[model samples]
Target: MAARILIVDDDPIQRRLLEEAVKRFGHEAVTADGGEAGLATLAAARGDFQLMILDLVMPDLDGMAVLERLAKAGETLPVIVQTSRGSIDTVVGAMRAGAFDFIVKPVNHERLAVSIQNALKISALEGEIRRARRPAQSGLGFRDIITKSPEMARVLRLGERAATSGIPILIEGESGVGKELVARAIQGASDRRTKPFVTVNCGAIPENLVQSTLFGHEKGAFTGAVDRHTGKFQEAHTGTLFLDEVGELPLDVQVQLLRAIQEGEIEPVGARRSQKVDFRLISATNRRLLDMVKEGRFREDLYYRLNVYPIFVPPLRDRREDIPLLVEHFVSRFAAEEGKRRITGIRPDAVAMLSAFNWPGNIRQLENAVFRAVILCDGGELTVDEFPQIAAQTGHVSAIRRVEGNDAPPPAEPVIIESTLPPVATEDGLIGVAVSSGAGNDPAPFGFLRSLADDGHVRALVAIEEEMIRLAIDHYGGRMAEVARRLGIGRSTLYRKLKEYGLADGDDDDAGVAAE
Candidate 1:
């Protein structure tokens, strides 16, 4: 991969030289004027940039300060600091602040290239190690999924049911919504728990190789086929085969897939006959297969075979309740992995800030955010400083109470209070709060939300939906874009509701909504 490197320096000449040197090494370079600008660039990139080359001495936001900020926020991006001969002692400080390597000024192009190579090598190795360790987690059924939301609870219930039967499961969700996690949970909890679990990313493989990847190929099956290869299907025999992004399969491959599902056999390339193989099928996708079928891009027979037991995983924005639990879980895991033992908890404002924004990338994005934050974190508790990109977005922090250990989650039931206003709390050893939604000061009893009416009956769906929309609008200060995002709906959908319920257009965001 061509690494995107951020070159931070005060001197324009130095920046230009470094950029040229990076291009010569076949890597992309992004230059920042100073340390402050460097930090801003990092925030804007959202983990796209892989490495940094920092100038040790700068008038504005010195290199040391940049490293400190990066270390505190759990930023794992490798840093290679460049300094002058006179500033040798400061190089040690930079190292302690998370600099991957250091080089002297009047840059030796060879030395800079070697340092860059080592930094990229180590970064790639770290990522590889993380992936190697994932299997260690899939063995633990349902425990690996961190969630407190009812939306997720429903998913889990469906997964548990699927585990008991031999039905083919089709898990639908936006990318990064943990569809694979749910698949693993089903396999782990099933009768085939000890059997091999083979996974294939249909989207990642080249079209020509998809057939050979899914079905074993005989030696000399095609050019570059020097050795017999056991494809994913044979490897998954008598166990489970998880085909991720299954919708990406070519039309021809879909026919074979449908055959395999119906007959429990797969034909490898250059094979004389199809071989019988028994395996549980669990497929996942971020696309609408029905629509694809209607568009004649997918085989209708294959779609029905896969959609027998459909389970929809809600996106992160729709399940804000899960963010705190997931944050705490990731903190505990990444802190140990990264050796940041001092970091134990996250600030309530930080949790609130995380909860307030709609994560378009879902859990994967949030996980990356927290990983970066943990590396950037400077203290025991993570703060907004650690999440600069998310903090830059329109969000607010609701004051909350932290419990013992600053690590335990608060009670689920909201404690009612006679306070002037309600406090929304998102906590895990962080903030706690009591909400008040009562009328006429009769010591109104309220939970995080109201489920029952004054007449002791369940509330109507329309009333609940309207209330949720209004609360989202109020919480986001009428920034309709934000309100729509946090509510997990489109701007157009939010506009329709505002008109339907006669809600005020906060900030007159209607112009933007209308354009949408």
Candidate 2:
């Protein structure tokens, strides 16, 4: 599909050049002379454009001001900043103002096109999330599964095949890996797509009421059972029933569930006879049902019934390649949900840190981390400082130390030097040996910094500095003067750091650094 792009630049020559480059990619291009004109054009044809190109320096409202205004107005169109040469400060400033990505001026057509393509991909992903949040009255489909990993793709293939048979299926994965999501995907893809997809968390319900919850209850079935209540199975008749955390179901409940599945009928807690009910069963669990059966915690017959068609979802750590796409998805999702357009995307270094860590809690953990970052992120690309847990989990001490202006010493060595005759020669030779050994053993912090410092990643360094200042301030009980005294810096310098880091004065919660 052809993408639509909007170019906002006061320079006529630059605008023409951008327009030509966008057309070369077979996309429709719209141009505006300045920020005001761009806003007016965007407001008029908001749905027409997929990406925006913004110039940092413009007449009658600069790029930062325009971006702030757009965010205030709740316009979330993707914007790539066009910065002048040697304008690192402006580039960082623009990024902090919510620019999607920035292109240094004296523009390279090849690089610009690549940047635009990436921004368009982000825009498309945001559009998908918006569609997912829409009312399900129209219909849900496999498109609800927002995954790009091979593991998920294979699971999806199996799910699609199993959805047609109407046989019982079990989804196995770590907690928060979206087991219910897979079940929903199956229901959406199956012949029962339009029918009700009832969900019940076996782990969340009390043991005493487990059977009643699944098999319905008659009036006066129990002390609190004042009226007749239909169970999840009955409600899901002619549709699909999703039993989450099925391993948590007690043995007695297991026998009843097995009977209901085999007979296609349910006997209410206080009823004399069974009522016929037909529905497909989709069970999910984070624990191993087979192991439970071996341990006598779960019944063997029930395990077999639920294991007829099992789907395993790998954790987020096993599929590191999908981290970037998932981060983009969550960023856009939370940004829209929170009604804040100040956040755009995560910094590449932060993405690297996320990819490196092991997500013990799986996709749910990652989602929570992203949401926490979004909430604490002060209107800019997310950075490593926004997620200190990632750095801690990944053992990125060297990276953190470098950010704190600490130089790591070389590895320890035991040596005894014997001086022969010339004192000057011996001293000089020892100094040379020490210098060479230090250089050989220790990695350069600047090199590590420079490697991740691509496309204005120096902004991440700024973020780290700001986080340090915030920590210092919090450590001193929001006392800026005390923090400045402890760091051996001036009070004004601390205040400037606070503003530079996008931290408000007197906000003392260290929760900002804790990646929820």
Candidate 3:
């Protein structure tokens, strides 16, 4: 297939010559004067070029720097590295750093043509594989959750089971793993689908207003209580109340929450008496709430009340087989949403690249990447360039180059791997958590910490803890309760840490609204 190729060279003569050669090889060629210009060109017209021919040594931002930047940015266009300084070491280094193909200067036309052909062929093959794996459309109801991976399939089964139980359910997973989606799916599948499905981010509410926001308040109860406010529990009467980040609720609020759940009644702030309210409660957090109980941060009674029906959603990296299906789903959805008729599918190579990435941001991140790709797509296909994060991690450029040439370095140790799966659930519906020896594919215990230490930029435990909490908050969609739970701390401690770190102070002033 004829592709648009980019050539990055400091020497004008070399650039022009390579351009002519690429054109002759049945591809359109774009040229960049140096490494900086090449990167600039790529950023400006991302997704326009399918492959790049890059010169290793440039005056500014040498090929290595460009490669590093691309890796950091997660750009994935296959790159062929050309250098006059061609020694075995240089070529090996380039390949290791993500150069697709290494070619010596004084280029040979036949060799260049052959390399291009090989890279394109590999690219095409990957595209075909992805197309083969992609489901035509996602399933409905709980299956709308979308996955072929056994891990997520199990979670969905539990979710489906939880839907009809008519009991409070707790969904647990890292932020962005779709706790909200799971909650919605449960509500949708339940008998109460006709009724309201209310959601409240517990952490987003101010400490002073947690009780009022959840259980309503009389007019003039507090300084900003301009009107009689109905709480989420009242709004979700006879339906579902999804409390996201339940770990963020203050201790006083937790006390009231337990009472409300136990008695099916809530006394609004400044109300004369408790009013009965009926709603199916569904709570989610990314935290280890059991640990919170041990630490005395969470109310044991409230934790038990909410943990009656627990569903743990698996992270994306743990279910990579589902990625292609999700990519297709998102691509089609975003294409239609953006009115982009040309954006029908992603390149197979792109799918492979995406599947290999450990998506720390999970499905939401993938959705965002696909949305961006669809908007940026210049053609019918979403190519490697469209998904920079995947590209960078997969080292697509280097791998492609190695395939295109015979003279390349042997493979190095893998820098990234899929995230480890959570402990399997026992027949009793409780997850079995235990440490395993790294005898097989299992990673060493605390491997990530070892990696951090090995990097030599050792962080203070407090700093690490702060960052962990921050990440958990982000992953759990700003649900502080979930963050605290995941961090094995109490909501109170989480709040204290947040204040100490100068992080979010649980003071989202306008977030006090009780509306879904």
Candidate 4:
């Protein structure tokens, strides 16, 4: 492959000779008059050139000074130092300053070609090493993830395979899509399962403290360094270091991070010596690192280093089929945690409602919904009444279908059940009953209640009082005096009925109503 070469020599004649010689050897060359000009060229090109040729002696900004600038700027382009005859000391110094190789004046074309070839080969090998190391394709540990969607299944399969590999892993997904969960599963499945799993939220740390937080700092490193602190890298030694929101790391911190990954060591703030750390890297980011790199907000080299094993966790909407399973799992888990033995499972109508929502917050949002529903559940099953936010959007009543088997389909139609509805005043100023499910031709009140309708036994008085009380309170915004006036009963009677129906506290009242 043709490589771009930069030649920096003070002698115009020597520079022209070197450029012509490299061009003939199947390489492109750009020349600079002096060391300062060479650096200026590199800075303007910004890593465009692959290799550089530098003459040791220069009037200004000597070769050693140029090498120092490259080191300070974190430029890794290979360099071939040129030295004059009897300048053995300068040649040795050039090598110590990080030159790829050295050549004497009146350079041999064959030796120059050989040196270039060897440098290119080493660079190629490093590139291959970056792309070669990958995790096994299977045997993932995903105990906490409950999913039935094919999309999620594929994600888990890939994650499992990546878990066994020792290379760095990059997980990408929207917030709440379980990126950290995937990271944990990968770590759990890895050989270092018994080792420490240290997690750091890169975006959460204060910008000024990010470096000290990741690389640690000795006492008196800065204003807040009253005590010595170990960094995440050292803490996760021989283990896994999960950097969530890694894309949010500042550019300066990205440089430090690249050095740590490339050299396997970190120099703590205010510490003279660097410490070696052995840790597996697993980074997660919601933002696209490629986009950031293009925008110059993220380092391209660091992006490549962290993206050895890429895994993407699909969002909840993309895998809607898994919602039911997730709901059931969360219900069971939260039920035991909340010590609610009667909360067996969610109703089919409630599940349908839940499955219909496009959970923008993903799995975490779903888990919170299930937990909240479990707390509100009064019967053995979680019904639509428990999930007001979902129910409000759906605008439907609970059909009360028992959870049949583990994977029963949702009910096709909602079952109408009469509940206590508020009373509305008639034209003649008398109380009237407004049927919640619309009036039916059966003419029998409380007909939908199987318990009350059995054997033609309609508990008319009890049902009327319940219905009247409910409607009155709802109509008058839960004002007991007005509810009593509308129902033609006293406030004492309204309170008595409310207590009898377990609505005394008015906690179960609809949010649209105001309680006095």
Per-residue accuracy of model 4 over 325-432 as CA lDDT, tens digit each: 678667766776687856656776577777777899999999998888899888888976677665433323322221111123334442233447554433322232
Measured by lDDT, the strongest candidate is: 1
Window of ten residues with lowest summed lDDT in model 1: 395-404
Runs off by more than 4 Å, candidate 4: 1-140, 397-516
Per-residue lDDT tens digits for candidate 2, residues 1-516, read: 246788999999999999998998767899999999998998887355778899888879889998999789877788998878547788787778888998888889899877886786567666767677632642355655766678887998998899788889989999988788888878878888878888899999998889888998999988999999899889999988999999999888889899989999889999999999989899999999889999999999999999999899888877776777678778878876776576756776677767766788888899999998888888567876667565544534333343334455444662212223332212112111111111123221211212222242233566446545654654456666677888899866766666565565454333322311
Candidate whose TM-score is highest: 2
lDDT for position 208 in model 1:
93
- Backbone atom clashes (below 3 Å) for every candidate: 17, 0, 16, 7
Alpha-carbon lDDT, every model: 0.78, 0.74, 0.74, 0.75
lDDT of 2: 0.74
Could you tell me every candidate's TM-score relative to the true structure? 0.53, 0.59, 0.52, 0.51
lDDT of candidate 1 over 68-94, digit per residue (tens): 999898888999998885465676777
Better of 1 and 4 by lDDT: 1
Model 2's C-alpha root-mean-square deviation from the true structure amounts to: 19.2
TM-score sort, best first: 2, 1, 3, 4
- What is every candidate's alpha-carbon RMSD to the true fold? 21.2, 19.2, 25.0, 28.1
How does candidate 3 score on lDDT? 0.74
Model 1 C-alpha RMSD vs. true structure (Å) is 21.2
